[model samples]
Target: EAAVTQSPRNKVTVTGGNVTLSCRQTNSHNYMYWYRQDTGHGLRLIHYSYGAGNLQIGDVPDGYKATRTTQEDFFLLLELASPSQTSLYFCASSDGDNQDTQYFGPGTRLLVL
Candidate 1:
């Protein structure tokens, strides 16, 4: 595997809550991304980055924030979490080409109560 790991495999919070999901990739990839998986939604992109301090907004970016502190670290912030935000989030890293061959972290499941 590519050694992409996520913190706090599971999380719970109420509506209008705050949460941070973290991901770290030791593979030295130049591209990192945050995505969410829902039952009927497949996977939706939330945010991404090309390198440290370089952030790119993804398809479904509302109600979320992201920061790339270092090439190995990326974070997803839900300052005012809503029930609709509950989903299985994934962190991935790629070499900036053939994104389909990304290495994915275990995943973080967020539940808004």
Candidate 2:
């Protein structure tokens, strides 16, 4: 089955810090995305790409960046992050089709203090 998951299920950091969270997929898919989940809010897309070496900014791209290093690996980068950036991050992947269903990861919990 096609699946996507993230690492470091929880994390804590201070203001103005750098954090890197990773995601991986086993579906051999060509589309990947990173989104943040917050209370009383819909999932906000941060970044996504069709394949490795390609990235497209989404709705909430500020203070966050992402990279698709390989077909099965993607990473999110938060540099000089702020408390506002603290939220649950989820990774997802699709089969590179417009109507393809997306598989979501468990998510990574981040806290900035």
Per-residue lDDT tens digits of candidate 1, residues 31-112?
A: 9999999998898999999999999999999999999999999999999999999999999999898635798999999999
lDDT of each: 0.96, 0.93
lDDT of 1 at 35: 99
- Relative to the unseen true structure, what is the C-alpha lDDT of residue 88 in candidate 2, on a scale of 0 to 100? 95
lDDT of 2 by residue, 43-93 (tens): 999999999999999999999889999999999999987999889999999
Lowest summed lDDT window (length 10), candidate 2: 1-10
Colliding residue pairs in candidate 2: none
The CA lDDT at 90 in model 1 is 98
Clashes of each: 0, 0
How far off is model 1, as Cα RMSD?
1.0
Pairs in clash, predicted candidate 1: none
